[model samples]
Target: MSTEKVRAYQPETKPKRKQKQVKVKVTKKKWISTGEKYLYSVISGAMLCACAYVISFSSATDSLNRDIESMEGKIQEQQSVNNSLSYEAEQLRNPERILEIAKKHGLDIKQSQVKQAGTVSAD
Candidate 1:
């Protein structure tokens, strides 16, 4: 019987490679056209005018509400004065009030004898 010799095989290793760096150039771009620029300015001006109009409208509405409230207060005051005047008018129409006024003015109330009053008064 003959013995054969065995050879061990070694694993292969890969070589390391160097990485290359890339350079990028950045450039500025003009994205607006002349016609678009004019349109944008017009739109901005219109927006500003609209905002001003809204503010003015709100102020006017607030002023109108204040005026309405003031007018209502005046109407209430006038109604109270009218009621007071009406009560005074009613008091003036009373018989006691009329007698008091007559007494204050020094007018006299008279009583007469029946036969003498009848003889004297027809003319």
Candidate 2:
């Protein structure tokens, strides 16, 4: 057996230090959630597309109307030209005018042989 010293058990104590108080800042919460924000964005985009479609349709309709009006104006002008040409042709086909032109050309045509030709009707 070896000779050994036996130590007594004693409790250790430490000095207390002052602790500083930590402040926690509270953040404000957003009224709209992320999911709600995405839903609103999709809805607004759809509405915008709908509005654009309506406006474009209206513009196309207006353009077609203008084109129709232009064609109508052209038809009216052509009808006026046709009317004037028909009147001039009628003037040229007059019996007196034909006789005068024949006389000017030194053709001695008898009045009895100068029969006035009438128009043939299909009906």
Candidate 3:
């Protein structure tokens, strides 16, 4: 009974093995990868080009509108000049004015038959 009690109280005779220290490699993650950076750059460049195109198109449209307005003004001025010239031509074609001019040119006409010219249209 004494031997059984001493053996029960004795520790195990097995050699203790040392625990292996595992080295964990802690790698810091990059905020942006190389591929992501290139994609972002391409997108930004495309946006910039699009903005430039829109601005240039707007400027060209404004210039075209200005030119059109200037042409319209010129056309109106020309129309006014044509109207005055047409009025002067009608005054010159008056029958009374023609008779006065013919008399001043020493044209002796016993018959005061003044025929008005008319436009002949082929209908």
Candidate 4:
């Protein structure tokens, strides 16, 4: 048997702080539930869908209005063309103008070359 020396355990003493110690703040962390997270995701998805619907509706309204404006412009243009054509027709119907144009085209307008039509009444 060998001779051995055993050491005794000693506790360390704490040092005294003179000034008031600042309290260390411990923040509590809140954890979200899986169900709550899923609910939030569903709500967000529904809101996104509603917003997209509104945006598409507004876009369609704008497109329709633009098409209507373009059609109105075309209608106005056609009306102007119609008015010009009517004016030209009235100008062409002048007897003096007709005679002048006929003379220029070497067309004869003798009274014997015209024929009278018989009048018929619809019953």
Clashing pairs in 4: none
lDDT tens digits, residue span 1-123, model 4? 223322233455689779987999998765987889999999999999999999999999999999999999999999999999999987867677767777899998877353333466685
Off by over 4 Å in 3: 1-24, 117-123
Query: RMSD of each candidate?
Result: 12.7, 11.3, 9.8, 11.5
Residues 62-101, model 3: lDDT tens digits = 9999999999999999999999999999999999999999
Using alpha carbons, what is the TM-score of model 3?
0.70
- Across 1-123, the per-residue lDDT of candidate 1 in tens digits comes to 223322224344678688797898987776997899999999999999999999999999999999999999999999999999999977867766666676799976563322212245655
- Give per-model TM-scores: 0.56, 0.63, 0.70, 0.53
RMSD over all Cα atoms, model 3: 9.8
Better of 2 and 4 by TM-score: 2
Segments in model 4 whose C-alpha atoms lie over 4 Å from true places: 1-32, 102-123
Each model's backbone clash number: 0, 0, 0, 0
Residue ranges of candidate 2 with Cα displaced over 4 Å: 1-30, 111-123
lDDT of 2 by residue, 1-123 (tens): 233322233344577798998999999899999999999999999999999999999999999999999999999999999999999999998888998999899988765566666878788
List candidate 1 stretches off by more than 4 Å: 1-29, 103-123
Clashing pairs in 3: none
Q: Which scores better on TM-score, 1 or 4? A: 1
Estimate candidate 1's alpha-carbon lDDT, on a 0 to 1 scale: 0.79
